[model samples]
Target: MDKKKRVIFLVDMESFYASVEIASNPELVGKPVVVCGDPEKRHGITLAANPLAKKAGVKTAMPLWEVKSVCPQAQFVRPHMGKYIEASLQITEILYEFTDQVEPFSIDEQFMDVTASQSLFGSPQHMAKMIQKRIWDEVGVRARVGIGENKIQAKMACDRFAKKNLEGIFELNSTNYMKKTASLAVDELFGVGSRMKRNLYKIGIYTIGDLAKRPLEEMKKRWGVNGHILWLSAHGIDYSPVKNDSTELQKGVGNSITLPRDYIYKEDIQVVLLELADEVCRRVRALHKRGRTISLSFRGADFNHPTGFHRQTTIPFATSDTIEVYQASLQLLEHFWDRQPVRSIGLSLDQLEDDREIQLDLFSHPIKKLQLGKTMDEIRERYGKTAIFRASSLLSSGLLFDRATKIGGHEA
Candidate 1:
């Protein structure tokens, strides 16, 4: 919170996916819009809702059918993640115009250190307004800005206070930090989750002020090192540096979809698995990476004992081949399925490793298969994703066409 420390700014794009949808199609402006998954395929969870939809009680992660019930007049649009990512990248470029210390927190949020650049661009508030204006003018999206001495304070202030104000800027510093945040709930702090919150309440620490004032020894006794960190954060103390790089190495790649109706037939589920594996493999190849393990998870339609099954299988070699991942997932599905009607299906690739290492076998090397996968990737990337498709995808139950141009089960 000291003025001498580096200044941090947390910028958040407002209703990002929905906003991008609106910007792309100006006719959607001023309408209550909710960006969701592909409705035709029965993947209909709300991913993001615009302000008008939010005011009508539509919420993110709510079922699309439920959203209609809450706000019948709301327009449902499929998400375009590719477009959103492009806009985010443009915004990142704009931020770098001001400072080199820009760390992208997510697709819609960034942390920027303008300490060294403040002299070049007036005060932090001025820089925040300039960035907000530039994003609006150039990218057709609005951003909220939070200014503080460190990342934690800037992020918390942005989420908790900045978005609600007209100026869309909030500053938290050592002088007025406690006074401004004393009445806030303990869980409202950035890093505190539900479990930690319950523990805090059990110890009579119900507010940020209470956590800030707790004895260090008592906190350490309760939560060890994390407890000490929590106390410091509660007092508006954070020293983490904002890295300049924006590229985040993906830890894994996967996809999941909720069926339009209960999938009663195993073959129908197999078709869906193939489609998901196609998308997942495409992503793995896009990153030039592969994994040794494939995981399959599904949710049942039964309400009585709604718990579903999840299982993983490890293969001998890493692969980004669609059929290989699908075969592995198929075997795990047969082993774990309870024969109950399935309402949802998910596939994930983990135990990730670089694609550079290829193990040789006596019978034949997998070099040919790898080349084939790479060739398919190149073809797909050159044209559209739907330009090339597996013959199995044209089957009666396949969702390949429905999902090819989509991201996270929504339209791209």
Candidate 2:
């Protein structure tokens, strides 16, 4: 028997944060609106903007003042993370009603394996409309959905092609994938980033068609396994599953931030490291997992390597305590620091295992610190993360509260 062609839908919320704002206040509909961080404190970066503002060249991450200059009539609003998260949950629930294989790619995007639902629901194209209509009817947020035979094609189609179409839905398969994507720039592919694009350009591979024609073995030899993956992605050959289980999907729990400004002092760097470690460990614990390896990464203000230098160290036992992870990360940072003005930092917990048991130390255990961390987690979960923050959060360079209100480094 031939393998069943998978039907995947990459459902992305259209201008999600702004849409939610419009949904809440119908008067804002069809108007140019921009969601951003605090504008007064110089942290006001454009997080999302409606199509009206986008048409006027209002781009995300541009300074709010510049956005105002571009579209003076645009209405700027602060992000309400709680509202967006609630809407996201509602969207997820609606997707679940259609299929059990809905995998949330981000707060505003989901990959749904609807192959099994074609018989019960109509065709994949029909299902996309149904899903979009339901989300708009129920949550009042518009969604752009792309349908394809696999995840990669679905994502690329949604991001590149579907978003440009008026219907907000598109379908691509083996037959038309090449014609649709071949001549596009290599950077437009799902997995291709700026560095990869530059490297590909150096090798005379500036287009998807160029990448598709490269010999896989030579590409792999040149860019290692990642190169081969990129080459395959260019040809729309992804076979990765849409993982629904949170535990199965996460290889690590991590977070990184490009600071609002560069940190020139070691104290400021330490503050950010501790805050990042706290977040990573809290997430690891929330998932009921612990990791033996803790990694720290940072980059200088120089934008040469946006990905940055990352280093990890393995401890004797698995743990999710923020202090332990922070201490481990501190060692990595100390060893790896090149003394350039640090601009960003990241922390991660890998080598994961179920946090089911803890082995007692031969001589002593840091029971007090473990208990304190657990207490803080409970307080934060109940009252809000900002309710009980560390003293370091008081530092001018700290971004604990700012980060708490954002998702993926933008207004949530």
Candidate 3:
């Protein structure tokens, strides 16, 4: 017997943060609402905007000042990431009622594989309507769903079609996806960003059809594995599965902060770097992972040009020691920083491995440092993050205390 076609649905929340705010308050039901970061702290970028705000030309990541200029009557609300997370979990639980193959793509998006569940739930479109209705009834949030034969098709179907449709549902399969999307711009295909579009344009590919017609080997020769993946996505061919378990290994661990103001002095920058290093290493230790590469990144205070540098170095040994990571980051900053005023700083640890075995060094006390880190982690876990911190965090430039109160760099 021939294999049965897969049925995948990508459910995306509409203006998630702003919608949550409106749902909880109720007073702002018909008003144009924008959810943003704290303007007083210079984190005033728009995180989400409701439909009315969007109609007034407000967009995600737009500056709050710009949003006000565009929609003067718009009501602003600070993001409640905790509340959003709760809603996301509730939606995930609702999805489980329909299928066990649900995978969360982001806090605002989830993918459901209903190949086997279609018999139980009826057609894919009917299942999508039921899921959308359940989410709206239970969570008071609006959702759009895209159905396809695979993940890539579902993602594009939702992002490019469903969200724009009044019915809030779309289906793109092997037979119809090309007919609908072929003449569209190359960048309209899933995963094709601006740079890739420019590259494709240089090679006489301007539409999805152009890319699909090109020989796969030529694309592979031009861009290697990424080229092949792009060709596959252009043809709506994705073999990836929707797995629920999170057995995937983390690629990196990092933290970044936008300073309340431009920091010019080396001492001030170092203070922030140390705080970031500590946070990153602490997370790595919690994962029981060690990394050999440390990366330092910064952005200049000039918003117009947005200039700075990102540099990384690999050491012989993998260790999650805060001081060691700090030292490496400090070196990178000293060597690369152009003495420019920095608006933001970031640090990350990658090239990871399980911390099952410790590498011995005659000059360094690795075991002792590891034990000390574990103890500090335990103390923080028991008493709270602010219970113990480096003395440097007491300095005026340090953001440890401020950061501890925030989740994903915003108020909790």
Candidate 4:
């Protein structure tokens, strides 16, 4: 007996942030709506735009000024990341009603393996419609679904066809995916970006059909493992399973912030670094992990000709202490930074291990610091993150207070 084909669905929310705003506020339903970051904070890119806004030439990641120039009548809404996250959780619950094999691809997209669910829900097309209707009726957001024999086909089907289909459903299987997409530009493939497209063109492969016909060994020879992966993708092949591990271990904890303005002074930069270290260490401690390596990265204010440096240092002992991480990051900045005006800064704690054991240090009092961090975490968890904060957070150059009110660098 031949094995049954896999039935995968890639469900993507349409104009997620903008749709959430329109759903929450009925008055904005018919308007061309665009959701964007706060312009005052220098994060004024369009996060999402409704279909009407798209018709008016608004696109995601476009500068707010350009959006205004194209569509002056567009209604702009600031992002509410917290609400979007809540809605995402609600949608996940809805997906669980059909199958447990749901893997979130992003804030607005998910992959669901429903091969075993056909007996309960009906055919793949029927199941897709059911999922779309349930999400719309329950969460007040429209969803498009792409059906396929695997995750890659489903994703490509949704991005390339379903989103544009009137019914908002498309199926691209192993039988017809090539027939449908082979003649398209190589850049139209799932993972081919501009650079990859250029490289493929250098090899006389301009279309997906050209790539599919190329020998797999030739691809591997040119791009190594990534080349092999690209060759497989060109043939509509992917072996990755849909995973839904809620307790997945994080390899690192890091935070980066785009400063509202360029900071040329070392004192101001140090202040920002201290806050970043504190934030990252807090997250690391929350995960019950300690890290031995600290990485520091910064970008110069010049946008046309970007200049920056990223450096890492491994300490003798793993630690989740904010001061220790800050000190290490400070050393990197002082040693590597060319004293240029910096527009963004980031820090990360890597080479992580479970924080079940502590290495005693006579001079550092590691145990006391851990205890203090735990106490602070407890206080913040109970009252609020702002309930307990360092004195440096109140400094003129500090952004902890502003950042505390936000999630993912946008308003919460």
Candidate 5:
């Protein structure tokens, strides 16, 4: 309608990890490639690779042994977070030349809303081509661009075209979405992935057309929160505001650490748990909020088993005092920990709101006074984070102490 007023664009880098690897060594361009963790690591898996490796049936998240079998000639590269961050920042700067409404969805993908600036740059097709060229020239990376009326449509169109190896740009609306996407697997939808498609298949909706034609009420009956999202996406409706602001402000606060090694010692776990509780409270207070619930998560070295334990005891009073909060979390851990050797540990305090409520107490602990908290916070802020760490957190100087942490990853 009237030249598609809500013009949204999705730019996705192809084979991100592999592309960065080859960018450094052009000699590796045409080789089957895999970026994986240490092959000998107990559960390490491939993270990403080039089209050549994908064609040979090598895939990300596959065990290293399986990946090697798939593409024996494949070259493996370790992850370089520093390089990826620099490239992502550079690509974002290039996109800002066209509009400030750019949102980085991940390290390799972004959403841009140019609805207001289309006339300034010409039609959507011309805008996409110019943006793609700018990215290639400035970031030394190739990207596929998709134009639609909103974020969901643009992202799905990008995935659709990228899989077909077509030109870098794809434009779609309600009319062409189904026909253009008919041959593509529902699992290939930008947000569907494989697990989501499996769940949706149980409801007899196997394609974009199937989802688009289904009634909203029927969709909600089974999928709950996710159902509404899929239905709205089928109709190409995404009203989320593009993010253009800083991501520095803390919303929910938490802290965690890995043990030097697997530990079944009750005293050792209790020490790390107390230290993590203190760290979590510090972060929560720094944000000027009181928390009502504590979430505890931990893992063992054999990570096929991960345990998440959450405790929602109403804070006797909403307070950021570490001792009080840590006591509550200790009770939760005792209830959940089965005495297994744990490799990782974490604690979270949420259900946060403004810390406006004041607790009335005739005899409060003197150390829990407001002055002491403020004094400690200032000293840490000014001197350094390490200026004051709990004795329990004292471990090896190097990051080797956190080796057990990768077991749980960020599910903590």
Candidate 6:
């Protein structure tokens, strides 16, 4: 028997952030709209909206007050995570109907291993068409799918051709490869980011072909593992396989962001750190997990590399008490939080445990501690993440936070 080849499919929701908003209020249909941060509270930032919003000169992460100044008619709405999650689940359910081997990459992207279903579906194009049709017909949302021999190519195919509706689906067997994959900026390729582009630019490498045709050893010597990965992608060589769902307990949770501009002030950096800690803790509590190791990472303006520090404490539980983790993380940050300008910051907590190991503190009012954490989480969950927080944080920036916890004469 002839050997069968492996195949992968990538499904991406079309303007998912905006689509969810439209679904919420039918009146917003075909009208300019954007969703993101609260604008009225002086921290309004655009998160997602309709194409009409895009044409009206609004963009994601752009301050909404500025957006309104430019386009007064544009409507803004807050993102509804519950609704987005529902839509994502519904989309996944539809995908499940097509194949059992689906892996969710994010809220709007996934990979489906369809090697086994090829025979039953007739052709990859046929399968793609049906999947696309099913999504629009069911959810009133459009998606683009890419079909290829490997995961990388499949995802690239989705990025290159995905139109507003099912227009993005590309089967290497059915569509001309160059017609889709070409015209894509080298930086647009997955795993390549702004920093990587600078390095490539310095070397006069501007295209996939430029990187693909380079010497493997030379590229590895210059770029390390990342360089080699880029070269492989340039030549359309990818070997990653589809993964199955695994509930292995997590050892840590983290959140990070790159500022549009580098920050130089010590206070500003601390503020961003606290916000990151708050975000990280929310995710940890959501998963009902605990972490004992806290770490901090700072990326320089040059983007040369990131420097970080980690410290572990035997906190008998994984509580969402930012006070505990904040202290530990801040202690580690003191070593690196210098006058140096930083472009990005990240936080992570490792050494996770289940609820079985949870215990209350002895010195503090243990019952109050537990009750306060539960009450705070409930308030934040319902009212919003920033519904309650240290007032000093607002006086500072939303970027970082520090704890008053001091250990061994070190700041936490």
The most accurate candidate by TM-score is: 3
Residues 1-412 of candidate 3: C-alpha lDDT, one tens digit per residue: 1257899999999999998889899899999999988888878889899999999999888998899899999998998888999999999999999999988888899999999887799988999999999999989999999999999999989999999999899999999988988998999998888999999999999999999999999999999999999999989999999988532446678888789999999999989988888888888998888999999999999888888999999989999999999999999998999999999888999998888788979789898998899899999889988999999889999898988877667777
Error of 1 at 362 (Å): 8.1
Poorly placed runs, candidate 2 (over 4 Å): 1-3, 256-264, 292-318, 332-346, 350-353, 356-372, 383-412
lDDT of 1 at 21: 87
User: What TM-score does structure 3 among the candidates reach?
Assistant: 0.91
Candidate 6 achieves a global lDDT of 0.69
The RMSD (Cα, Å) of candidate 1 is 4.1
Listed in order, each prediction's TM-score against the native is 0.80, 0.85, 0.91, 0.86, 0.73, 0.70
RMSD in order of candidates = 4.1, 3.7, 2.4, 3.3, 5.4, 8.2
Better of 5 and 6 by TM-score: 5
| Tens digit per residue, CA lDDT, model 5, 1-412 | 4764588888899888788778888888779888876544333577788889999998777877788788889888876656777788888898898898888887898888898887699888998889878877766678898888878778877877743666778888766777777555567666686888988788787887777788999878877878888778776778876676523223456765555567777777777766666666766677767777777877775657765444455565666777777788788777887877777677888777656565676577523554466667788778755676666656432222343233222111
The segments of candidate 5 whose C-alpha lies over 4 angstroms from its true place after superposition are: 1-4, 38-43, 182-199, 221-225, 246-332, 337-388, 395-412
Reference-based lDDT, each prediction: 0.86, 0.86, 0.91, 0.90, 0.72, 0.69
lDDT, model 2, position 271: 90
Q: Model 3: which residue pairs collide?
A: none
- Per-residue C-alpha lDDT of model 2 across residues 226-318, encoded as one tens digit per residue: 988988998999999998985766778888877877787888889998898888888888787888998888877766555458788999988
Rank ordering of all candidates by TM-score, starting from the highest? 3, 4, 2, 1, 5, 6
Which regions of candidate 4 are displaced past 4 Å?
1-4, 246-254, 284-299, 302-336, 347-375
The superposed Cα distance between candidate 4 and the true structure at residue 204, in angstroms, equals 2.8
Task: Give residue 381's error in model 6 in angstroms.
Answer: 10
- Candidate 6 Cα misplacement greater than 4 A, ranges: 1-3, 164-166, 173-184, 246-252, 256-325, 336-346, 349-412
